[model samples]
Target: MSFLDFLASQFSKLQKATLVESFQDDLDSSVTFEVVDRKIPFLPLFDVRRLEFQRGSSYSYSAIYLNKHLRLQPIYFAVQRLTESFFPKLSSLGSALVLGCAGCSIPRFLALSSKDCKITGVEYSETMIKIAKKYFIDDPIYHYFLLLHDDAFSYVHKTTEQFQLIYVDLFLADNNCPQITSMDFVNSISSLMAGDSIAIFNSLCLSKEDCMKFASRYASSFTATYVFDHQFHYYVVFAKTSSLSTLKAFEKRAMNFVRLDERFIAP
Candidate 1:
């Protein structure tokens, strides 16, 4: 099967996934959390577990587990693709910051992608941080990862240190953090990026107009802005320079991200 076809199959499997474990955090009543397992039909051995948040009638897959031994994320396909493709360009950089510490999937991926790069992740929910540690990042591979239990909004405003790579993924279930599209948050992210660095935002769960508006907010702070639609979700990229075109050139390997930046600004 083709790459798109394979993606469609994976997406279908998630939609029909079976619930494996369901539980609640007594400390946090903001959202109900669950652990689910999804596998290809008729392949019981090919199992992948995921952490999800139940919001009303919908579910958002926050992290996916291939195996306890592997430091990779199957749900964050777009961020993984963009980072792997763009990280090499910023060779001088050795630091990355992830605003949302859901399962530390992005941090884990960053660690494996660049061993020298120091990774820091901040999560707003203390319970969520505990859940990540207990379920996802218990392995010794995360010994060097700095995990902070703090609100992303407050942390960004107070942080003075800059990083070559930053990721914004503050989500509650399928709903995004309302502050994610605010000017203050955008400016904070801009301040965190070092020279010629890049930032990736998980812009899903927003309407098309809202997504474009959010991307436009970064145009004044960054040299180029690009948006990619992969796995039925939108991801926005902001960079100090126009280095993201390489991603468009290698669409086949990257699973063909539908570029939507042209609708608002030229990148």
Candidate 2:
């Protein structure tokens, strides 16, 4: 690895370790803290607590400030770019799906941004769902959000409903869920997408070789794909149908939500 890359990795590790350590210290003091152990093999103990902590469950899937602190990590900034900064029409979307509801962070953003948007979040872990409902979801009628305790794979295949936008943020502790990389699953999901639909696929802990190759292969499943690398280790893949290609200068069309700091951006 290059010297700069090594330094960034070390910095990221140190930051996460420090944040998680502090969060662990507060676990005993709060009554809201909920701990859920592995419901299946290879899953680690998932901890759900209230506020002020940067999210780092399982591995480092997504990091964001909870409660009032609001230190939205880079991956979330990437999500903001993908969701808020990609499509201006997202505000009017009728239906949306979030495959993995980690802390329900992105869905929260979606619900708030699009008043008319109806979101259906699928999470396998009941504990996470409970935590999300308590901390993430805002209102019952206004937000129009629903959380389902089911495997994302089965739900996507069986659901008769279609969505305008789909966010695939599925991951376990350290490894990504197997279906995230499956072509058959992607094809099944494609069937549930509207004509102008888009799907955001996140693959964390990616090597440069893996990122480039995976981007090329996965882009084939859609009309076009946009790849954004966040903090070296994470790759956010935005794949959309061919109809979306007609939009002129689509990337810059979506308005800015947050002005990201230079320190947080990847080279």
Best by TM-score: 1
Deviation from native of the Cα of residue 102 in model 2, angstroms: 2.8
Relative to the true structure, candidate 1 has a C-alpha RMSD (angstroms) of 4.2
Tens digits of per-residue lDDT, candidate 1, 119-213, equal 88999776677678777677665545889988899999898999988999987656688888888888888888887577888887886567777
By lDDT, the best candidate is 1
Q: Rate the local accuracy (lDDT) of all candidates.
A: 0.70, 0.56
What candidate 2 gets wrong by more than 4 Å, as runs, is 1-75, 138-142, 236-238, 241-248, 253-267
lDDT accuracy of residue 169 in candidate 2: 77
Error of 2 at 45 (Å): 31
RMSD of each: 4.2, 10.7
Query: What lDDT does candidate 2 reach at residue 114?
Result: 74
> Candidate 2: TM-score?
0.66
Point out where model 1 deviates above 4 Å. Answer: 1-21, 25-30, 37-46, 55-58, 66-72, 89-93, 242-256, 263-267
Judge candidate 1 at residue 167 and give its lDDT: 92
lDDT of 2 by residue, 176-227 (tens): 7766767778787778888777676666655556655655665555665555
